[model samples]
Target: MKMKLELFLVVMAVVCAAGKPTSKAAAGRNKLLLISFDGFRWDYDQDVDTPNLDQMVKDGVKAKYITPPMLTMTSPSHFTTITGRWVEDHEVVHNMMFDDKTNLKLPHKLTLKKSAWWNKRVLPLWITAQNQGLKTASFHFPGGGANYSGQVVDRVLFEEFDHPDDNETEWRQNIDKVLSWFSEEDFHFVALYYGEPDNVGHAKGPDHPDRKKIIAQIDRTMGYLREAITRFNLNDSLNVILTSDHGMTTVKKRPQVDEVIINKYMDLLKLTSFEILDYGGFGILTPKTGKEQEVFDALSKVPNVTVYKKNEFPESFHLAKSERLPPIVVVADLGFNLNSRFIVYVNKGDHGYHNGEMDMKTIFRAFGPDFKKNFLSEPFDSIHIYPLMCKLLQIEPAPHNGSLSVTENMLLGPEGPAGTEKPGSGGSQGASLSVALLLCMLLFMSDVL
Candidate 1:
């Protein structure tokens, strides 16, 4: 009887050992499709007319909200999303940038590879994914035009579309282009960025009728992507993730800009350009020269705007600590926005508001074979996305300042029966730690016995 019991115990141990998930399948090749819709708010996921995105939520996982960078501009927010680093670290803080050394202030262009202001040390996810020998592609990534050898970037389409200047219309073509590319290439990872909703939202405000129209347009585009993937028989092989850089809020009121107050300190400050631009609620005063302190003090005395130095910006904004950030960052009081000559001419609406307000919370969702069904709900940081994509494509995580990979696993659920290890919940490598402790305890017990 004792011999029989021993043999049964050994068989059970063997079965248990075989059932444990190993690192092999986790490190295996898998395809990833990362898409971002600019200015896509959290409210769009409601039971309204979103048939395409609603299906994705039912088929996969969705987050309550995703946080954006401090400045909340396209350059910075999108940069943070792709590289998992804040604007200060990546150094693309605003759409209009100033190079202090050259005394050159230039409107931000999506320059490929060579910009004095952008920090290239913080690599993008495509770089890491490509380094692992997986194919990669990007469509209209905010700064995706830059050709940094640091990340493994394969095919990048960075130019802006000319006709139909509406982003929603152009986005449909971009999505079709990406689907065609996916069909032709054996790409292991791909990213597509849509700038139209953000464009319309900024131009028409979040509550404008055009904002809802843009949402519908995006839904149709998403449907095309989902349908194309299915038709190509690549659905099972693809991990589709969708998110946005930031959200949009309505401009309830516009603040008057007193040219007299601006001029009082304008010449005292080394004058760059004196135009005031709406930076969401606050305005950005870029000195043609780098007199940040003078500009900041001048702006601080204005009605309800609080001035924040580049360094003084909250750490939660995750702006890289840098001297190059705009000299005077202004925050408008609630219910107020800055009325710039530029804004009056173009956008009827805009973002770039207080860094900490919940109004800026954006949307994030994932639908694919690897993602769990209807699992995630709580809000998460945008930084977590890089690591999750890396895991899906079997690439090394980008070296970043503490991303939230473990917290994001709520999207994946208890790791599948396949060899993919469950990403830990609290950011601790708990499964590995638990295994080590168990092994040590077993060895100690064996020696004593």
Candidate 2:
């Protein structure tokens, strides 16, 4: 009898061990598609009809809005999404890479391929996923093409020079290509990029009719992407995330408002050794060694522009600690543009302002079998997206600033036998407990036998 009980207990232990979800396949790792439609504002759909975007909200999960990191440019903000670190930490400080010693700023396209600018001892999502036995493809996602610590993305596509941003045909072609990558090539993840509404926004302002037209195009693109997913038979196995880097606001142009021209306040060649001005809303100046305070003082009095010493920059911005940042940083007030010397034309729409502005908030939408249906979450920071993607991939992530706790609530529980409740609702654990209790009852009954 004793020997028989020992065997039964061994069997019970084995059963319990089998019940635990230890293997990767137990939870079913789903592939991910992270798509960024550059400069799609949080409320871009509010003024326009975006049926596809509206359908996304109904079919999946949506956030109130997602906030981008400081120095909110294309490269820095996108880097934050992948690295889960602030721009001050990741150090992709701007769209244009600045060399303080040479006082030269590379244009946006050149900066995309410059390895030194992007691989700042950080592993972006592509390299991180690759390190853990997954394949990744990047379709012109900013920072996706750069080498990271001697490692490169598995597959990459760079946009041809002056590629038309509004080519709907090519956009669908890229979508088909991405679907092929997942369905035929067995790619696990992809980060696709689109330049739209941003280009229109830059030229026509956020509220212009042209902006609305581009937005309609983006809506159609969303519909096409979703339809393509179904046609490729990846609807059940893939998670799709639609998001943007930053929002666009109307630039307060001259004649309507005074422009913030720095040279008008202080002589550029005399007081500053280097200046990164004539951009939209942000400025960085490397004062001639000892002219930091003078430059700060002179620029402080300039109307519509706020200047700061590197150390004195607002801690809330999360970008002041970067080595790449110059000593003097200036930001124009909302809707204003900063000029280096003379009054010059600026984009009708611009970003890179303090993120607290409502216009600076962007959009986030996540859809997949793993996510809850028709869920609307409160606003979250974009940095948290990295950890969320890592979780969806079921891979261990390297040390990152984002917390999985912030995003896990949006996901449903792991799949088990049918009728299992979600993870947080205690269904799996409850089932395990019930099984243990039944085993105990059986043992007590066996004592009589």
Candidate 2 Cα misplacement greater than 4 A, ranges: 1-18, 26-28, 415-449
lDDT per residue for candidate 2 within 131-166, as digits (tens), equals 988999999999998988779999998876678889
Query: lDDT of each structure?
Result: 0.66, 0.86
**Candidate 1's error at 88, in angstroms?**
2.0
lDDT of 1 by residue, 5-42 (tens): 56556655654654465563454445778888877777
lDDT of 1 at 249: 77
Q: Weakest 10 consecutive residues, lDDT, candidate 1?
A: 257-266
Residue 246 in candidate 1, Cα distance off native in Å? 1.3
Q: Pick the candidate with the highest lDDT.
A: 2
